[model samples]
Target: MASRSRLHVAVFLAPAVLVYTAVMIWPLFNTLRLSLYVEADGVRSFAGLANFATLFGDPRWSEAFWNALGNNFWFFVVHMLVQNPIGVALAAILSHPRLRFAALYRSAIFIPTILSFVIVGFAWKLILSPIWGIAPGILDAVGLKALFAPWLGREEYALTTLALISVWQFVGIPMMLIYAALLSIPEEILEAGEIDGITGWSAFWRIKLPLILPSIGIISILTFVGNFNAFDLIYAAQGALAGPDFSTDILGTFLYRTFFGFQLQLGDPHMGSAIATAMFAIILAGVCIYLFAIQTRMRRYQF
Candidate 1:
């Protein structure tokens, strides 16, 4: 009977397993295989970990790798600092019982989340452009025109500014996720808190906040993975060079440049594969840390 039940479960799971193997497992294996071989002068040869060695050992490759990694971290930090807080604030406001037009506000806030990265990037680029942009006009209307400059065109502010723009586009995601989580908390629990002399700010900080921590953890992990995987926005706004002197280059764009030739530098498939593998490893390590280390502790609380 046990063997029959096992067979039944396997039969039920077969289609999903097949699809997973075909779409995800197969491509991952292929990339890993390609990473093991080197191609040059129209010739391919097995290179073991030489590609990875060059990725880390060679200054030319290593410099860009480290720079991109650092930039990616900064991008992630910006989202954590600006985006999540803004999302939480908005979610708190929208969750208020007396708030009118809440549905409309939620929909409007979420609109940008559905937009393609290309559209968001170019729209922001045009909005921030100095020559024929509305940003300067708005600042001028506010009597702050002097502060307006081409932020996207400047090296010192480019990456940070772009990160803010991305935050603007995606903040809605966290807001919605957190809002739902907040709503899921029992109203009785909140009322109990109020009866126990906990209400308003105190209720939120001491009660609601702890309850929503698991959602925040999920958002943080998602942000980490999404930020590391991001490519389209930077590509659309700054091109593959991620210029303004490569100020916005992240692992995604760096891998793109390595995989495909740009200007004078020829593409190196092996190097690209190495970069991709490194990114995979980084993402895996982060997820593992979050799951094994942080998640266990976070889940121990009944809330």
Candidate 2:
């Protein structure tokens, strides 16, 4: 009977494992393999770390690579600073037992997350359009038209503007994660807090917040991964070039342009794979850091 049950479990898991291996594991190894070779005279040859050297040591490639990397970090920073905090606040509010229309509020906030990136990108782009966008008209009505500018068209403002737009679209993710964490707190714990005269904000700070630390950590790591992986929305909004002069270019866009080529540039698969490997290293390091922090916290709790 135990053997049969084990077989059942394996049967259920096999498809997903196979699919993951094919789509994810295979591509990853292939990209790494491709990165090791350089094309010369219409023939590919093993170049080892030469591609990586060029990426870091060569001025032309290194400049764009570093620029995109810096921009990607800024993008992640914006989401961390602006999106996660707002989501946490919203989750706190929505989790209030007395809060009315909580379902409606939750739905409204989260609906944007399910929308296609193309739709959100185009919608925001249209709304922010300088000539015919309603943003100017609405600002004019509110006596703040002076604040309106061609944000996407300007180098200084484009990346930040797009980052904020992304924040607006995805803020609800952290909210929902935190909300579930809040809901999962044992009733007995809350009762004990109340018995100790801990109530309302005090109860939350002394009791709830401590318990939800793990969930918050998870949300932070997820945001890091998601922000690093972000491509579709930026691509839809800014194109492969990630223009106004590549100000909005992140690693994903940079990889796309390098791997697939954009306009005058020809695709260099070896260089593209090198960039992808760098991204994998970055994400892996981030995940490892999060894991280390979690383990340290757990050890402290155990002690």
Whole-model lDDT per candidate: 0.92, 0.91
What is the per-residue lDDT of model 1 for residues 1-303, given as tens digits with 9 covering 90 to 100? 555656767999999999999999998877777888898779999999999888889998899999999999999999999999899889988998999999999999999999999999999999999998899999999999999989999989999999999999999999999999889888988999899999998888898888888899999999999999999999999999999888899999999999887899998877788888899999999999999999999843453
TM per candidate comes to 0.97, 0.93
**Against the hidden true structure, what lDDT does model 1 obtain?**
0.92
Candidate with best TM-score: 1
Model 2 agreement with the true structure over 1-303: per-residue lDDT tens digits: 555556777899999999999999999999988988999889999999999999999999899999998998999999999999899889989999999999999999999999999999999999999877999999999999999999998999999999999999999999999999889888888898899999999988888788777777888899899988899988999899999999999999999999999899999899999999999999999999889866466522221
What pairs collide in candidate 1?
A: none
Return the lDDT, model 1, position 262: 89
In candidate 1, residue 237 scores what lDDT? Answer: 95
Candidate 2 backbone collisions, by pair: none
| Residue ranges of candidate 2 with Cα displaced over 4 Å | 1-13, 295-303
